[model samples]
Target: MDTDTIDGQPRVVATDAALAFIDEIRKDYPDILFHQSGGCCDGSSPMCYPADDYIVGDRDVKLGEIGGVPVYISASQFEVWRHTQLIIDVVPGRGGMFSLDNGRERRFLTRSRMFDGGEACAIPLVKRG
Candidate 1:
C-alpha cells in the first residue's frame, strides 16, 4: 500500500544514514524485514532479518513502514509502546546475533518520539491481523 493509506503519519521511519546502510546491505540480502525484539537475546532492539528467515505471526503487530520495509513488534510489546513513533537509526556496534545487521558493526536502533494529537489521532492502535 502507498504511504497515504496511513494518513501520512508513519508509525516507523528511518534516518537518512540508516536508509543508506540498509541500501548497502540490500546488495547482499534483497528481501529484508525488521522486528523489534522484546528483550532477552536481543535486548529490546530493532533486528533485521531476511524475509525467508523470519516469519510474521499472529502475535506480532505491524507498526508501519521504515524505508519501505515492514516493521513489526511482538503483540505484548506493542501494547506497551503503541503511543510513540519509532525512528529507526543506525549506530556503530555489533548487531544482535540472529539479526542480519550483525557483523556489519552497525546496528539498527529505535529512537522514538511521542505522537502529537494530530499524529496520534491519525495513527490507529495496532490490532492483531
Candidate 2:
C-alpha cells in the first residue's frame, strides 16, 4: 500500500510541531501508524496507534508517509478527500482517548488543501493491497 515516488509531491505531509510530537511519543512507542477516523467524537481526525495493532483492512487506503509514519484513510473517507493534500498537524486539545497523544493536550489532526490540476495529476492514488 505504499505508493511513494521520488519526485512526487506527497499526498500527505506533517507539520514541524506534529513531527516533534510524534518524535516524543515514539520514544515510548517506537512503531506507530495513523488511521483517518470518520467524523464522530474524534471529529474526523487521524488516530495514532502502535504499528500493526490497528488492522489495515481491504477498505483502507494508504495516503502517504508523514514524519516517517504511514498514514491511511478509510475507503469512504478517501473518496471524499482524494483531491486534496492531507496535512497532519497538532493542536491543543484532548484527542481520542486511545490515541497516544490523548493526554498531551495536543492532538493529531487532518488538515487539507485542494490540489491544483497539475498537482492532482502528479500525486499517486494508493489502493488497498
Candidate 3:
C-alpha cells in the first residue's frame, strides 16, 4: 500500500505479517484495535488495544487495510510525527510483543523509546486467546 500521512504523522505500513497477526488476534477477540500515541523522529511507540482508548494526539493517520482490518493513530501524535513511516514486526518479549520502526533507520522496542519527552515504558496489549 502507498504510504499516507494524516495531519503530518507518518502512517504505518500494514504488511502481510501485520495483517496476519491482526487476523489471528481478531479471531480470538473481535474488538481488537491498534493505537499509537507517538511517531518517528520524535514520537511514542505503537501498541494494540481491545478498543480505541488512547486519545488522538495530532493528525489522524490511517493505516491501509490489513487482512481487512483497519488501523488508526490519534490526531495529536499525527501532527508532530507526520509523514513518518512505521514498520511492524513480531518479536519475542514478555508483555509488549510488537516492535516499531519509525521510517527512520532506527528501530525501537517500545514507543516511549522513540519519543524523548514522554515516560519511557513498554505499552503491552493482552494477547487474544
lDDT of each: 0.81, 0.82, 0.45
Q: What digit string (tens of lDDT, one per residue) describes model 1 on residues 1-129?
A: 222224566768899999998898888999989999878888878999998899898788787776777888888787687677788999999999988889998998889888776766665554545
Displacement of residue 115 (Cα, Å) in model 1 is 0.8
True-structure lDDT of candidate 1: 0.81
Question: Regarding lDDT, does 1 or 2 come out ahead?
Answer: 2
> Cα deviation of 58 in candidate 2 (Å)?
1.4
Tens-digit per-residue lDDT, 4-25, candidate 2: 4323667789999999999999
| TM values, all candidates | 0.86, 0.86, 0.49
Candidate 2 — which pairs collide?
none
Ranking by lDDT: 2, 1, 3
lDDT of 3 by residue, 85-129 (tens): 556554344323342222223332322113222211222222222
Show model 3 residue runs off by greater than 4 Å.
1-10, 39-43, 52-63, 96-129
Query: CA shift at 88, candidate 3, in angstroms?
Result: 2.2
